[model samples]
Target: MPAGRLVLRRAAMLFAALALVAVGVADGTGSAVTTKPFLPDAKFDYQIGGGYPPASGVRVVSRDVKDVPAGLGYDICYVNGFQTQPDENGADGQPLEGTSTWFAADASRKQLLLPNPTPEYPTSTENQRYSTPYYVDPGWPDEIIVDLRTRANRTTLAAIVGKQIQACADKKFDAVEVDNLDSFTRAYATLADRTSAREGTEPEEGAPTLMSKNDALAFAALLIAKAHSLGLAIAQKNTAELEGEGKAAGFDLAVVEECGATTECADYAEVWGGNWVDIEYTASGFSKACTSVKSTISVVRRDQDVTKQGSTGYVYAEC
Candidate 1:
């Protein structure tokens, strides 16, 4: 072969090889190629229960999936993916006329219920249970955890939570924020008594199952895949410990709660960079976060309940 022709042929082969490698990379990681929307470093709001006017400069909002998105900016629909919300009447209150089925059930086919322990409004009935299948968090009796440990339960969860993600897309929201990714961590703490008692024994016939971190990660990945399929990006809500796993599971951004108060803001900042938003519940937390690197990471302080502006307890501030 002519020397020039031989060199040209080799160059062509190298270019083709590189093209194949690019294709493989794109296929192997959807996050690399998918155009998921991200949070902007603009005024932000986290109003899950009540709707409010966007403060001056507001450009991003996170509201309950059932609520309408802010008309002016990127909106994130919040879904409680790992636990059942309190009945429509409110936590530990009467279940709505036809909403009891929303809660999950345990192995014995019995609906698991947790007590509501709000100090100001403790439940009148100590044994009252919510309509959920997963074990309830002892510390937060209002939330009944969902079972993410087994495939069957995860499938069921997918059906339940996947609809919410779809709803977000249907509403034209930019992203879906799935909360309680760390419920598995709380499961260990809340289920310690039952797990310790049965450590060496055969499991009881209808005992509650506690999910491991891996179980939660797998379930999150399932939800992320579903959200992406619907053309909606997903956010990793809180759970700084799982930031890496959240990224691996295909979460596009983060809606972190109290990361600055807990000193875990840096971890999430590193993972999502400008794609993350943090909310602090206290004045001191807001101050601390504003002085740290998080000041540049889109931090805000809001009332714990995230009420609306006219509500008595409503609070909102930005770094």
Candidate 2:
């Protein structure tokens, strides 16, 4: 081809490339590769009981989202991704038998409550025994509830959580909250105990189970993707560790439990920006959390039970 013709062809190709780049920028290509924003609203409510049409004048209510509530302004979905609920008789009852492949106890001697001792906190239950099934190998199905790291687990979680997101959409909720993001840390003890037992070592008295942080991040990424696809906003339950792992985890806001009780409030505030709502279950905790983050973050207090509206021990307050 002639030099002039070649130059013209090159120019056309360059123009086409530029056009594509412009289109991507205009339509969110950079956004596709970047993290989502964390926006905490000023006025908020945290209600997970009595099926969601929470008391009057409440603007936000965190719920299971799987069952969307009627006339809810904002909905945060709850998912037990970390620990498994015990079956009849717990270990003696085969708590996780059908659902989990992971279960181990040295000598088959059953202990009521498994022990968990973290530096800042300890498992509240002195006899908290979970069905041994969820304690099985993390790789196996039914071992852990959420299994955020496994593709299979992620798929299952997404489906269920997705339903909640859809419910939020259906109910016209402003966002979706996912609980148990911090279960990885919470389950660490139980998981360690299982690992020891599998290796023929005697299981510790009350070890907690641990989830793979990498896997959890991957799972959150997928969940975020689904949420964004559905045009629904997502919440970071309580996993402060993921603050630096990249925000593609589909979080737009945060709902922290006992932030006052735990030192994690500051971490959540830093990561989620100024848009977060914290719940304090104790009077001391509520006062501290509100005093500390009230100016920058929204804070509230609810009775520990977080019971249904007319329940005996219902308590709710806001600061």
Candidate 3:
């Protein structure tokens, strides 16, 4: 070959080798991680309060994944992955029985932390106090025991939520809402003390329970991965602390309760961008959220009781 042709041939061969190397690196990175597509600036209504269809003009509705459609816009299924739903009877009926307990600060006992209290609200300090009207069901328990911080707890919850995920797929919903993401910081004062008490105990017996904070993140990541694999969007329900960790945990959307009322909407805006949906319980809260994020995320107001439609009292408003 002429000198010029020989030089051209060598250059083409070098380029081919570089392309192969690039492909190899791309393949390696692809196997390491996968991300979900985010659906920001969407509309939604949390109507698990009423089993009925969403009112006119509502674009999305959240319901127990097990239940059929309520004839709403897009379906955003509900799953109590972080906490258990109470049985029909009452607190005495049967606890959601999460796998982990508070592990009192002393590490001597396992206790359940109560859901984070809304503004000016506190979870029941005692079980007796929990039995009161304000502490009643439909809203949330003043407190309950959980094992969510353990490997076993993570596995169990993953399995339970896996079933719920399957339900979402079977029902053909667009997304899944995992409630109680902020329970860790909600009633931490009281429950944190319990976990301290229960530390350094004998190896816990019984089924698996709550994973450690690290474990919880791992579990959340797994759920996010699985949901994404199935083409269902996974939401981070009310956990602002987790917002920084949201992308790492694999959450695609957010379902915030009272963010505007508590001045927490900005955080959601930062994390989920326009993909958040804030559910306010008061008119003031609704106004605040609408004024701020309506141009981005969806906003709505519902009765504190989350009452059913056509009932004596049911409140639903959108921004």
Report residue 200 deviation for candidate 1 (angstroms): 28
Off by over 4 Å in 2: 1-41, 51-57, 66-73, 81-130, 136-144, 189-210, 246-248
Give the range where candidate 3 is weakest over 10 consecutive residues by summed lDDT. Answer: 1-10
Best by TM-score: 1
State how far residue 64 of model 2 sits from its true place (Å): 3.1
Q: Which of the two, 1 or 3, has more lDDT?
A: 1
Compared with the true structure, the alpha-carbon lDDT of candidate 3 equals: 0.55
Where does the lowest 10-residue lDDT sum fall in candidate 1? 1-10
User: What is the per-residue lDDT of model 1 for residues 1-319, given as tens digits with 9 covering 90 to 100?
Assistant: 0000000112333433532332211323465444345534657888886778888888888888889889666788988777666556646665532133345333332323232223233222222344122345444455566666578778767777787888888888878988777766554322334344324322333334355778888888788878777667778888776646777777777788777677776777666666678888888878877776444457888887788889898888888
Q: Please, what are the lDDT tens digits per residue for candidate 2 over residues 123-241?
A: 32122233232332222222334445457756655565566556566665545665556555434554355445444454443344445677667767766676665556666776665
RMSD of 3: 15.1
RMSD of each: 12.8, 14.5, 15.1
> How much does candidate 2 score in TM-score?
0.63
